[model samples]
Target: MVDGAGSIGGELSPVLEVGKSLAAPIWRQFMYLYNYSTNFKRLEKEVKKLKNTRDEVQHKVIAAQRNVEEIKQNVKDWLTDVEKTITEAEQLIQEKANNPQCFKRLCINYKQNKKAFKLKREGIDPLLQKEKEFDQVSFPTIPQDIWLRSSEDYLAFESRTSMVKNVWDALNDENVYMIGVYGMAGLGKTTLVQEAGRKAEKDNLFEDIVFVEVTQNLDIEKVQTKIVEKLSIKFSNETERANKLYERLRSGKKILLILDNIWEDIDLKTIVIPSKMDRGGCKLMFTTRNLDILEKMGSTNNFQLGVLEEEESWNLFRKMAGDVIQTHELNSLPNDVCKECGGLPIIISTIAKALKNKSHPSDWKVALRELRAPSPTKFMGFLEKEYMKMAFKL
Candidate 1:
């Protein structure tokens, strides 16, 4: 370039004029014969390497998806580019191969050579190293509780079976934005709600189903964090989490969010739960012990879970207490114990399981006496709901 420098495009430099005599031979030796022709071969070799590298990346993406992961955007873009480049290269190679090894072939190879060189320098070579960073191509996309289907441990009581159907139907109803499930403590409200979710999932009623646990005390950050974790992203704008969540949910339609064990009414939006959804759009299902709270939270359609009847209660009790209750010495005693449970499945389960290993009648009699107490001192505090004390009454 310095030798070719000139005075304002008027005259060539003196040094360039002196070297001009060698230009033709130099061009034929390097640019025409050695470089262009060899670039085509070089391009072919590099293109094969590119395809092999691309196949490796494609395998990673497929494996990641099978593991329930979301592929990164760049990885997808790279794969798309690989497909395009390979397709174009394949066509160019076929066209150039049809030409004879003459000037015509050189002309054809010229274009293919530049493309192949550009692809290696700008697209393939750099990308091969860059793509290595994407070996772990995806991330876990589903939330911990997205897998919250009903398990075998779920007591399939008559009332719960019917209520699960009812909840599922209400959520599917177009006008229902939120559905409420309320029952006394220990009525298995959480379990029934999960069963409803299980059914909805089986039927593909929603694109995504997430279960959130909201106890008597609300933790706004904890709630928001749970949602963020499900989305497989981070949002730490302590104050702006709700707004961010609102936008995300608005854009991502058809999500079913189940909030379990709510003690009081809460503004769903405050936790980033969208207030508006399209027809057959996102819906909320919350479980609480209070229908009043559910109504306050805008759940006009509510399902009240009833306690198990005597027979259902007895059956559940027998299942938990096992064959020990069927022994001749303990058989009739189990009936009296079941009655004291007042058809409350949790209480029946608790009392029956407590007596499960007691082979002696004296131990069973002592357990029956404990069930009659104002507060079952041996059981957990949550097991002492007012109804529990009342049910223990003789």
Candidate 2:
């Protein structure tokens, strides 16, 4: 009985040791789960607060976005209203201008007939007052916003407009003091710069805008004279002119100096124009047919003007052709002529002007033939004759 009791006790001892090990791990797992649950309960209030704040912020953003859209719509409506009013006023003025003879007769009759004079006064007084008011309306107070003199045959196209925008943006950048616009001859480089100058002036970007033409021959004296003349400054001594010009430019106000049709590099210092790095607010803009000229002049930014796209070329051609193009019999001929123009504004405008009064399809065909096989001597002779005709008409 003693031996059996010993064997049973030895087996029961190993079972008791295993039970102790399992009990210790179970107690540790229970404590870990208890701590994790406590932490989650503690964070619950903060998580709720964060979600509420997020919702409030989202609502505010939506409200702000709505307000912005409302303001944009209001501004758009205002601009539309102003544009409509201006159009109506312009039409009225044009009508009055067109019937000047009728208005003169009415005025003379009003002087002789008392009853008619009273009725005329009633009918015309308001219009006259409105006309006077329109005239008196202050023109935009832009300083020296002059369109640089150029050939009136210039046409605007998308590519040219995009280049202008790029130049404008570059000029707005404080780092860009000198900008160069280069293109092939007769590609409307002069007109592009002129438009940019006009826009900059209207935007009040500069205090003074001066345009000077620098032909193939760079005449320093002539350029200086023109600039000083535009500034209303006089300096008699040739040597002191540079100093005078520099001082004038340095005198507080920003100046935009446009040099058109440069054929070669120009030393800005020689002409008394401030260099790109010298002046604070003064800016220099020049156009050349050669990109290398811009590099020589130390241009901070340069833009190359390209020809008009086919659609833009066609639109400009049709506008220039005017009533002559309305004849359906001349279909495809006008398009062919425009295509032959090779998107050159000068050629297109000159040809269009020459054909402005003619409606015959044969006349266009003849013009197209000449354009297709233009003889230098013959074209020059034709242009001279046209110029004389235009001069006589003027």
Using lDDT as the measure, the top candidate is 1
The all-Cα superposition gives candidate 2 an RMSD in Å to the true structure of: 32.6
Question: Local error of candidate 1 at 258, Å?
Answer: 1.3
Q: What local distance difference test score does each model get? A: 0.70, 0.63
TM-score for all predictions? 0.61, 0.58
State model 1's lDDT.
Answer: 0.70
Residue 238 deviation, candidate 2, in Å? 2.1
- Model 2 lDDT per residue over 1-394, tens place: 1121122434534433444366776643433332322322323333344335434434544565554422234333433443444354344434434543243344322222222223223433333333323221222222343464333555657667777789889878877888998877656677777877877777888888898888776889999988888887767787677688888887757888888888889878788877656785788888888899989878859999877788988888888888888888888888898898788665666677777887888888877777777555433434445534432111
- List, residue by residue over 192-302, the lDDT tens digit for candidate 1: 778778878788888777787876679977987887666555566775666666666666567788888888899776776777543236788888888899888878889
